[model samples]
Target: MATSSICRRRSLSPRRHLTTSPASFILLPLFSKKRTMWCYQNDRCKDNFKKSFRLLKGCASERLSALVVVLLLAIVSYTLYEVQYKTGIEIVPFLPIDDSGFETYNEKLLNDVVTSKAAQNQLPRGSLMCWVMTTSIYHKTRVNAVNSTWLPRCDSSHILTNSPRFLDDQIPYHTVFNSLPESYYKLFWKTRLALLYVYQNVSSEFDWYFKADDDTYVIVDNLRKYLARFDPEKPYFIGYRLKRRMPNNGYNAGGSGYAMSRAAMRIFAEKLFHDKSLCPYHEWEDYAIARCLASMNIYPLDSRDELGRQRFLPWRPEQHFHADLTPSFLMDPIQFWGPSIFHENLVSMHHLKPDEMRLIDGLLYGVSQGIWKPQKAPNSSTSLVNSTEASPMEDTIQPPTVSF
Candidate 1:
């Protein structure tokens, strides 16, 4: 048993010897060196990778910042360019030359008076002529004549026509004319007043009613011919438009040569009677007229050449229409008075001198086919009709008389 025990111990001792030997220890040391080298290399590589990632992140941030800045600047620059493109051009104003008060015989009143007297003198056979005067009054005789023969005379007594209650409070600059309460109102009143007169009285007159200002010349034959062109069944307003810059909401600051239409009269009357509140006071006459028509869905036709201008004449043989007429004294010396000058057939003319009646009458009779020479002035021997007082003709010459 001792021998068997000794053999077992020997076996265990050999195993132990193998485990504790210097050669084995040296091999273990070599394995430890290899592991340390691998660990060191791994640590260095990890550090380098972390450094590279940090660099890449910084570069991306900088690039993004620069791109954002460029975009912001571009957006700001584009907004300023559009603001400077809208406020450059403007419109002109219409300022009448003769805006004086009438102390003596208002030509407008005289015309009405004479028309009434002539109508009465000729009794059921004479034609009645009506005239409209802006910024002036007429004689009593003329007023009577207008009442008796011309139908109605419309005058704005410098009274301002106010906007409706709801509109007045809502509109901007409503109280701007407090000092001259009616000043702003007068601008629109003259035109509207005339329109009202026509609406109430002259819807159906002898044959036709001519609309013109004191400073205009009306060629009766030419007007007759022009009137003939329009079918009374489908009446249209006729006039010359003052070419102005568009997109302007303000007044059309110029003369509207003249407009005539049976439909215009009735339509305007209906509109005014029905929706008087819709009519706003405007300083521009033409614009007001346009507004009145627009309310009724009636627009002007593009017939511009019917009226004559200082630069161009009408194409028709008998010069029947003209605008912007000035007195000979106010005109340039180089200008010439042609056959179309105010005469017997003159529907209207502007700026005639008080003493020029003789000259005007002579011209009228002289141009007659047999009365006198076309160039000859009339003789004083002819019976002269003076409409100075409140004669029956005076009533006829009141405001609203049709003049052309």
Candidate 2:
């Protein structure tokens, strides 16, 4: 009904203009008019074309913008799906190696480290000092399990913590960094500050520094045996090496724990942590430290055994044991890692509960030792077969080692 009224008004308006004006009556026969939709005037035709083109252009721009947004969202979603952190998964941050603008390394640098290992001694006597990360919340639970099981095996061990009772407790808890609030986010600062404390106070007393999470269980003797293969005087950051892209190379997983040779500890404790330009404050403690180390040409060292079995595992025993994906995911599981979860003489396993910690200790020390003692064969070398003093599990004897 409204359209009929509009049509009636439109039809009458042209007739009304014609009847009212003698100019329109004379001009109506010319066939071209400026205001009419079908006008063939050059200016009117050009204006109409411009308006139509603008409308079409606006519509196309909107469609293109929507298409771009959808494509961007899809790309981001797929990237997130690929890099999402799962239980015991190694998180690969989408950080370009040049973002830090630190030193870059090549294959030769890694080759040198491997070659240097050949000149080092096996099972050398070295003082291993371990520091564990803990908060007030884990003090009674995970800390106690750590102390009872593996902490004693270290030549000396200190608990790096934020407990209010740091000095009041009889345990050798280091509290130089107790000033910070006990927050997980602040663990990065806690980790760096803890290293500073060890550097200042007791670094001279140890040959190697092993840092671990409180929930991690360490086969300290196996760790000692592993570390003995590298020169303590040379800088080494040894752990479960996560394969990041170029320049970044790799970094030790913070959860599984890592060993720093005395030289590496000294480098970090004395210089790297102080220089924010080289090691800027990052939310990730491991990556920040890694960047600092890499700036000085001290990249992560492969802590795998000769047969390519992993020594430091980021996941707990079951999590690693039942893993289905390769660490890097570009290769088959067996090709990337070994056929099994990890080396039999694994240095550390992380993400354990308080009960699991005690359970692992019992299994390695009591159950396995009691059930599977391998007697020294007549032809066996060094003769420390199934020796508890040698390790919780007997590592195959190295050459030139005499009986204890």
Candidate 3:
């Protein structure tokens, strides 16, 4: 039995050896890895790789968020700097060109008014003939104002300009020169040309030649009353006198209005045509006229009220009434009308702008006809107390010192 068992054991041992050999080879690596702790190490390496990748991604997202916030702040700061202290551009109004074909007239409109007045015979023609030194811009409005209000009272009326339009019959465009004067300096030539025209055309037609700017408003009735005493035959030149420089022989303030008698016009015309040097060109047209008259020893007549105030207002009414002229009761129309003396006897109003000119015509007309009365006096306050109360003769006849 021992022998038989030994043979069987020996046979099984060979088979078991063959199977164990292959199994041992496979299990040998697993046993070696467990001994070295390689399984735990591999697991740790994968976990560390995943954690590193997540941290890097989180850092990149934070950096991108900070960059976006900084960009927004930079954009807001620049916008505030521009708004605080920058000067903006200025916008100006457009002035239209005032020229149409020269020597045109609104005759149909003029004839309707003139003939209607003549038919009514409400306005009797006076001996004074008025002329306005006007331009293209003032024709429709300014000239029309004179025509509707005061010009009808005069025996004859005319406008002298470079290019006459809207009233061909009344406005005589002096085509003597190439063009009309547009600037203040050019007025010297303009006045020169006007004087020549007056000399040639209408020197003998009227007793007095009244000259004024288109902006000036004249109370024709009051003017007639004022000149009733003065003879037209005498060499009379009357207006607001200005003698700003030495040898202050007064010259009429052109804007305030002036009147030259027929005798004076004749003399001026003769001297201007015959002796050109006597009436030389000047920067100011009024100054040039004064120079011409001064050469002939004819000075401007003083036109002032008995109270020594100027009848011709060279400046606006508002200028005379201010804080400087205190004791404001005199200017208060509510105080008294009789003592409200500044413009009570006012004849010619000057320095009127286009809009103001349109409104003042009716006011002046109403005042002249006793329909509207002045309630307030002007503030004739001066730096020197005595100057405000000076005599009319002294104030008007004396040399005036003015700056250009």
Q: Compare the candidates by TM-score and give the number of the best one.
A: 2
10 residues in a row with least lDDT, candidate 1: 155-164
User: If the candidates were sorted by their lDDT against the true structure, best first, what order would they fall in?
Assistant: 2, 3, 1
- List the candidate 3 regions with Cα displacement exceeding 4 Å: 1-126, 166-178, 321-342, 364-404
For model 1, give the RMSD to the true fold: 29.0
For residues 73-181, what per-residue lDDT tens digits would candidate 3 score against the true structure? Answer: 7675434333221211112223222212112211121222211222223222347877677776766777666656666666666666545455444433332322544
TM-score of each: 0.39, 0.58, 0.53
Residues 206-244 of candidate 2 have per-residue lDDT tens digits of 789889998899999899888887888999998877654
Superposed model 1: Cα runs more than 4 Å off:
1-129, 134-185, 202-208, 245-257, 273-278, 302-361, 367-370, 373-404
Order of the predicted models by TM-score, top scorer first: 2, 3, 1
CA lDDT of each prediction against the hidden true structure: 0.37, 0.64, 0.57
What is candidate 1's local distance difference test score? 0.37
Error of model 2, residue 25, in angstroms: 64
Whichever of 1 and 2 has more TM-score, that candidate is: 2
RMSD in angstroms, all models?
29.0, 18.1, 29.7
